[model samples]
Target: MNTQLMPSVSVEDITRAHLRLKGIVLDSPLQYSHRLSEIYGANIYLKREDLQEVRSYKIRGAYNNMSLLSDAQRAQGVVCASAGNHSQGMALACAKMGVRGTIFMPSVTPQQKVKKAKAFGKEFVEVVLVGDTYDDAYAEAIKAAETNGWTFVHPFDDLNTIAGQGTVGLEIYSAANFPIHKVVMAIGGGGLSAGVGSFFKALSPETEIIGVEPKGAPSMYESLRAGKIVNLEKIDSFVDGAAVRQVGKINFPIVQEVVKEVILVPEGQVCATMLDLYNEDGIVAEPAGCLSVAALAKLGDIRGQNIVCVIGGGNNDIARTSEIQERALLWAGLKHYFIVEFPQRAGALRDFLHVLGPDDDITHFEYTKKHNRAVGPALVGIQLSDPATYDDTMKRMAESGFKTRAINKDSTLFEMFI
Candidate 1:
């Protein structure tokens, strides 16, 4: 592997990509996040592709790939599968080009994403909701393509699509005349990385392109190290947008050539990042959308580097904000749930409440006594705004003579007891 022989990551390619996608995609804002920059010792510039028309960097790839289609192929229409972004990208591109399209999404996808996919198509494409995971939908899309004679438009893993995604690098380099030392982004199918990394590699060869993935779903991370696409047996769908079983074929090659480092973020950390974006910046960032910001907590230190973190997408379904917040608490170790063993006496519950710290609030409480009401246990959830407060709260509970068992990270018992 001669690092110098193949110029997959180069400036010329990135510049060409910028020229290619100039009028097609928005420049997307590159703004400084004061709060984040202060927290993580670095010059943090958030590439807000989340504000793009389709609320993601996906449009760049979809449009680039679809635009290269011959007139005859465009008439034949294109088909693709995505949990959200890519579908919307194809929809918008298809509508603009008057090319009919069929998009397949997993059944578990949120209603908001489905709606966005619909709006992006604007009558130029047909949305087909299918399967339970991105892999399932991708498989279904491939199957349907054969019967309908539609060209399967992969979300990543295509040359033109990579070129389209490369546009981001083009915009960033042009907008920031100064050198950017580092770039970080979330990788799903890897098209965004392939394209963006390729461009950055060419333009700013010294700039590092870091890809972040949820620890629960490390398909791309594993694939990159393995030097080929690899499959994960399981992935937590909490970050539903980016949880993928395998990396894209075409996307992997580009990543191998251009990516500098890959980082894995905990799902809970992603949740915390989302909340930070919302509470501090007044921006609602979905779990996958918060990947780059999530990097600040994991990337050891970078005091002086000019860094850019891509806010990949912002299609946050308002309905799930509460759950996101809850997850954030658990991840931050500020919330704990306990199943207390106590005698079912009059002062039992009262005594427990008195032990809670001043800032601790009872978020959830449930109890059940066996056939005998005189003795049993109760399951309680304590939500502390600050994790530091838990120690005092526990010390008080022990002093008050209350015996309890904690189960915060145990998913199995959490579902059954709390």
Candidate 2:
């Protein structure tokens, strides 16, 4: 653990970045969210970075970093690694500036984002699919950049990148009619949080800065608690945009200094939030994009408080919707998976069906019969109308003359099956 102080990006630096980004980047809306306000009983505003041309705030930093490159550097080109959003930003930047570049992305990155990155950059950017996570691709990008002497545009952590992200806070402050009580945003590599937090602390000292991270990939959350940077051994890459094994070295110190609190939101809750945003408000937000709003439940008694939640991006792949809904259902306790021993005799399955309540429906079932076995284990998935009835349902199943084991309740089984 290193306790050394790192260079900070000043408010002046962000203001200058804001100036440089004018005309190049859209001033994304700071729109009032009526649905969220009613639910949380707070005056909630959303900084819709998802509405940007590249559907993310990443363009701010990517463009700022690329724009500052000297003519000689631009001619030599640039390199970067991103899960999705940042690559799209860099791709757009490469095309807009006419700079040839290479973008490395994880193999697990959504195809929607991969296509967009290629489309945005056109002939100027080469998209390379590397390992399974951003960190994996980052290593390869770093090596390639070092070998070729190309300018490496870091996704987060660089002074210029932090400054560019800070402009989001500047815009939020400028557009708000009331004094902001709190500013909530997602922390990926800590660039967004560090930049915005620094600006808010300088201009609106009383306004609290809250950083949200996926519980499965709590790099920033763990690092802050440990009082230094702590690299994670593994992470759930479901929230791919924010899923990194470690926060940027430069970003950690700044975030540690400026952010008032950090919240760890479960990946399941993030999925639910994504569905809510889509179904309720007609908003299409990616998983990481929903992190800030997903964290509102953890913030107690924010009634009437003027809050701002930055919606980071909207590059969601339609194909992932089923998985997102499954996660959401599981998190809400409305879904369950179980291993059940069923009698080989006829009518056993029909008798077992009677154990479920009227509102409970079987979502999945897999069974294989054995030649002379008295019983066989079947995998069953059930969805309930009310989570409160889970215990009652389990009790009924136990008394129904069938052996059963709840997969959802067992961590090992949950990971293996679900």
Candidate 3:
């Protein structure tokens, strides 16, 4: 790739952005992760962007972009769409700059984030909950900006936004005591990756830039493969912070040129990483926040190398804990759901229990008795102490002559039942 063909967001632009964001955004710590390093056999460092006041690196971009607005533009106010983090950043920016702003967010966004955004903005911003996804909110936001004649603060597409986000890379490069072999980060609309990746490419040219996207929403991954921006028809919104139908037009080309690879991690794996981060590292990372670390397993042999994983945000809602645990268990194969047909006789359930391993436990059971039929279908959820015993459990069920179908393997059934 020719450096000349790169987008206008140069290292100088990022440096200027760094200066603009100096007092506004925290110089988030770059702390070494002993647990991660011991596990991966690599010197793993975590760029703690989650430590920022908004608990995200988004403040860098949002504040920088808003600060550059002209006097007229500031008076006219600003509009933006975000899943969560950017909204919080913009909300804080609006309050500090004394500029009135309107923020549109997906209805599915975590309530905790929505409340935080409002609290940060106080009287300076209006929160509008519309649509089901970021793309939908973005469409509505764009229309509002045009109709209201307000300055639109793009979450990830604008040059100023990209440059601001690049400050993360600038900090990493400056703070690192040793050479960084790789830097991994989550890609939403590609702003962070494009910004950070470009900085690394220009400065520490040897350091590999790797971007991670949820497997269910691989907008950037698909775009890179097609050699053009590709808009996805649908995406799993579980990783709301990073899930997007399309990568930003301005952010796409820069990422293509600077990023060495984009890894698609399963949403389940992201959940598992979130749990691990919370339990082991005392890090409360949102689903998207743990994406970079979730992807470390896929990076094959990084032993004895210096690596950095950017924890994007700590805006995780405590309400979603049960869902996150369920996802992690499902991904680890420790949990299974099934539709089991059992005879209506009183001893039928007891007989079925014999098929389960000694360590296996039933987590869920729902059954409706059928008056006319000899057998009735029961929804059963089983959790195993060891995932390796799954095959044995299934074999036992087969040998026991019970009619059973696994719901975990069927997406349609899993959604309808689980």
The residue pairs that clash in candidate 1, if any, are 9-201, 9-202, 10-201, 10-202, 10-203, 11-202, 11-203
Expressed as tens digits, the lDDT of each residue in 1-418 for candidate 2 is 3535567888899999999999878899998999999999999999999999999999999999887899999999899999999999999999988999999999999999999999999999999999999999999999999999999999997989999999999999899879999999999999899999989888898999999999999999999999888999999999998999999999988898799999999998999999999999999999999899999999999998999999999999999999999999999999999999988889998999987999999999999886678889999999999999999999999889799999887989888877
By the lDDT metric, which is better: model 1 or model 3?
Answer: 3
RMSD of each: 2.4, 1.5, 1.1
**Per-candidate clashes, comma-separated:** 7, 0, 0
lDDT of each: 0.82, 0.93, 0.94
Of the pair 1 and 2, which is ahead by lDDT?
A: 2
For model 3, residues 36-133, the per-residue Cα lDDT tens digits are: 99999999999999999999999999998988999999999899999999999999999999999999999999999999999999999999999999
lDDT of 3 at 115: 99
Model 1 stretches with alpha carbons more than 4 Å out:
1-20, 395-403
- Could you arrange the candidates by lDDT from highest to lowest? 3, 2, 1
